[model samples]
Target: MKKNQSIYLFVVLLSGIVFTACNKLIGIGAPKNQLVTESVFKDTISIEAAVLGMYSKLANYNPGTDVGTATSLFNGLSADEGYYFPGTFYDDFKNNALTPTLYYIDGYWSNLYNVVYTANSIMEGAGAAALPEGYKNRVMAEAKFVRAVCYFYLVNEYGEVPLVLTTSVSESNVQPRDNVGKVYDQIEKDLTEAQAMLPSDLRYYGGNRTRATTWAAGALLARVYLFRGKWSQAGAAASTVIGNPGLFSMQPDAAKVFLANSQEGIMQFVNAIPSSWMATNLGASAAAVTPNFVLSDSLYAAFETGDARKANWVGIKVYGGKNYPYPAKYRYINGVGAVEHAQLLRMAEQYLIRAEARTQLGQFTDAAADLDVVRKRAGLGNTTANDKPTLIAAIEHECRTEFFCEWGHRWLDLKRWPGIANPAVTRADEVLGKEKGTLWQSTDMLYPVPQPARNVNVNLTQNAGYTN
Candidate 1:
C-alpha cells in the first residue's frame, strides 16, 4: 500500500466519477463512492492528470450536443450571424424564443458548471498537497484560469449565475445567483492571479499551445476589461500580449489562422480526434450537400470587396440553385490526419481588444493602427475611420467579420454595444428588432436560467421574459 500507488488507484476511480458527472447538472446529489480530493492530489502524476482532465472534459465535443459547440451554434443562431436550417431543437435559439425547458439550454448550463466544479476541486486539492511550491502554484493557476473562462461565459449567457467556488455539493446547491458585476469581479481576480503564476513561455506545454500561459491569461483579461468598459486597463492588458512579437504574431495568411499550433494561437484545444467538431457540423465536404448552418445575408455582405477572409474563411455551397455560405474556418469535416484544432484564444483577438479599448480612450490613431493589422492581413486597406464614433463602428465591424460563427463574439458584442439613439438600449435591441421584427425583446439579451436547474435549486431565479 505505497503512497503513490494508492494515489494512482484513487485517480482511476475519480476518472469514472468525473466522466459520469460531466453529463449531468451539478445540482444533482454527488454520486456514492466518490474518492476524497486530498487523497488524489498526494502525488505529482495524479495532480497533472487532474488538471489535464479539465481540458479533456471541455474539449469532448459531441457534434451539436456539448458546450464546445453550443456557444458558436446557439449564439450564432440567436444573433445576426447565421441561420439554423434544421428547425429542430435549435429553432428556439434561431428565433430568439428560447425557453427554460429546452434540453440544450440545460445541457450548456450543466456542462459549464461541470468544468467549474472540476477546477474548484483541483485548486482545493493542490493547495493543501505536500507538493513542490512552484509546481503547486502552476497547477492552481491553471485551474483558476479554466474557472474564470467558465464563469465569463456563464455570466454573459445567463446574466447572473451562482458563483460556485467550492467542490462541496451542499454549498453549491443552495447558493443564490450573484450579481453580474460581482461575477465579473471574480473573473478579473482569477485571471489577474493566473497571469502572475503562469509561465511566460508559450512552449511550456512543449509548444503545443494547448495549455494556458501568461499570454493566454492576459488575452482573456484584456477581453474582460474591454467588456467591463475599463478602457485603459484593457489596452494595457492587450498590449502585454501584442507587444511580445517573438511569442505571438498575426498569421500573415488568414487561411492558416485556425491551423493546429499556428503562430497566432494563444490557447487552443487539441481535438481528441484528428478533425474538429466545427468542421464536421458546419462544413459540408461536398457542394451537393447542404450545411446545417448558413451565414446570414447581412454577415455575408459585411465583407468588403476582395477581402481575403471572405474568400478563404467562408465556404459557398450551391444547392437547389441558391448559394449558402457556411463557416470554413476548420476546413476538415472528417478526421483526416489532424489538420485543425479548436481555437479558444488567438493573437487576432488581442489586436481587436486593444483597438476597441484605445478607441474608447480616444486614442483614435493608435486604434486604427491596431485595426489595420487585422484588415491588412485580410487584404483590405487601412480603415477610413478617423474619429471616436467612426473608429468604434469600424472596430465592431472588424470583430464581426473576423470572429463570426467562432465563439459567439458577435452575439455578445451586440448585447454589450449601446444603441445609436439611446445609450440605455443595447445594439441587440435595435439590430435584432429590425431583423426579427417583433420577436426580439430587450429582456431576451440574457437567456433564461434552465428550468431544470431552477427545479433542483429553488434559490435560482429565472431571467426576465421567461417564466419559471
Candidate 2:
C-alpha cells in the first residue's frame, strides 16, 4: 500500500473512534480515544485539522458545561461581580458554598481535561510524524500553548491537580495530584517553548485573532508571571507585547473592543456560530425582559463617575419599575446587527499587567505611566498615585473595573491580593466575608475537586474544604 493510502485508512478509523469514545471519555476518562496515531499526522492537512479540532472544543460556545463559558459564569458568581436569580445550582457559587457534587463543577473539570488530553495527543503525534521540522515545531508549540492555558485555570480553581501530559489512559487514570508550584513550573516551561516557536506576525492567523501566535504566548506569560509574583519577568513579557504597536493597540472606544478582530484583541475565539454565548446570557434580547445574570451592585459601583467603560460596557434594562445592569461588553445577543468575538487576551490587559509588575518592583513612576494609559482610554485623568503602596491600590482598582464580568479576573484578583486593612488575609477573605456575610469561608478560595473525578481515580484527593 502507498503511504498516502495507509494514512487515509488511519484517518477513517480515527473518525469512528472519535465519535464512539467522546462520550465515554468526556468526564474523568480524559477523551483518551481522541488521541490520533502518528499515521494521522503524516499529512499537513491532517495535522492542521487536529489542531483546529482543539480550538473548536475550546471555543465551544454552549451556555452550559463548556469550560470557557463556565469559567466566566461560575467564577463571576463565586466572586462579587454578579448574581444568579433563578435559584439554580449556580447559587452555590454566589454563596461561596461549592461542593464536589455540584453539576457545573464536574462539567468544568471534565471539559478542561478534555482540552489537555487533546493537546497531549497532538504533541505526541506531531513528534512522531515524518513532517517537516518547522511544521512539526509549530504544531507542537500550539498544542503546548493550549495545554498551558487549561493548566493555568486548573491550578487556580482546584489548587493541586494531576499534571497529565501524555494521552495514555493507564498513565492518566491513576495519576496523583501535583503541587501548585510544580504545575506552574510546567505551565511556564510550555509557554516559554511556545513563545520561541510561534510566528510573531499577527496576520499569521490570516488577519484573524482566533489562533495562537508569539504575542498570545507572551501576553499569557505576562499574566502567569504576574500571578506568580515574578515582577521583572512579568513586566518584560508585557512590555514585549506593548511595544508592538503595529500589531496591537488599545481601541480608543471601549464599545469597539469586543467586536470581531478588534485591534485591541491579542487573541480571541471567533464564534463558531453567528452569536456569542456571553452575549446571549449576559445581554437582554428584549427591552422588557431582564437577564437572569446581572452585574452585582458592588461591581457596578466600582466604576469611577466619569469612566467610559461604565457608559460603554454596561447595559441597564428597566423592567417592572426596576433597573438591572448587565454586561454589555458583548452586544450582539442574536448576531443580527454587529458581530462580536469571545476575547481571550487583549492589549489593555498587557498594560495593566505591566503596571502591576512595575508597582511591585517599586518603579512607581513607570508603573503610573502604564496605569494612565488605561485610565486615559477610559476617559479618566492620570492616576494620582505617586508611590508604591498607592500605585498598587490604583492598579488593583483599574483591573477590577476594566475586567469585571469578563473572565473571572475579579475572582482571581480577590484571591491573590492582600486585604486592604490586613495584609495577613487575602482580599477575598476580607471582601467576600463582608459581601456574603456568614456564608464565606477561607477554604472557599479554592473550589472542591469534583467528586466524579475522584470517583474514577482513587489516587485523586479532595481539596481542604470539601468532604467525600
Candidate whose lDDT is highest = 1
Flag regions of model 1 displaced more than 4 Å. Answer: 1-14, 19-26, 61-63, 273-275
Report the error of model 2 at residue 281, Å. Answer: 2.1
What Cα-based lDDT does every candidate model obtain? 0.84, 0.82
Clashes of 1: 0
- Candidate 1: the clashing residue pairs are none
Taking all chains together, each candidate's TM-score versus the true structure is 0.94, 0.93
- In order of listing, the candidates' clash counts read 0, 0
Model 2 has an lDDT value of 0.82
Candidate 2 residue pairs in clash (backbone atoms < 3 Å): none
lDDT of 2 by residue, 284-332 (tens): 5654377767898888899998999999988888778999898777767
Worst 10 residues of 1 by lDDT: 22-31
> What lDDT tens digits, residue by residue, belong to model 1 across residues 1-468?
596576556555666766554434455555454437777788888888788777766666344655657788888889998886555656788788989998888888888898887888889889989999999999899999999999999999999999988777766877899999999999999999999999999655877888899889999999999999999999999999998759889999988898888899898888643235677565656543787788999999999999999999898888789999998887665555337778889988999999999888889999999999999999999999989889978988999999988888999999999986677889899889989988888888999898887777888988989977
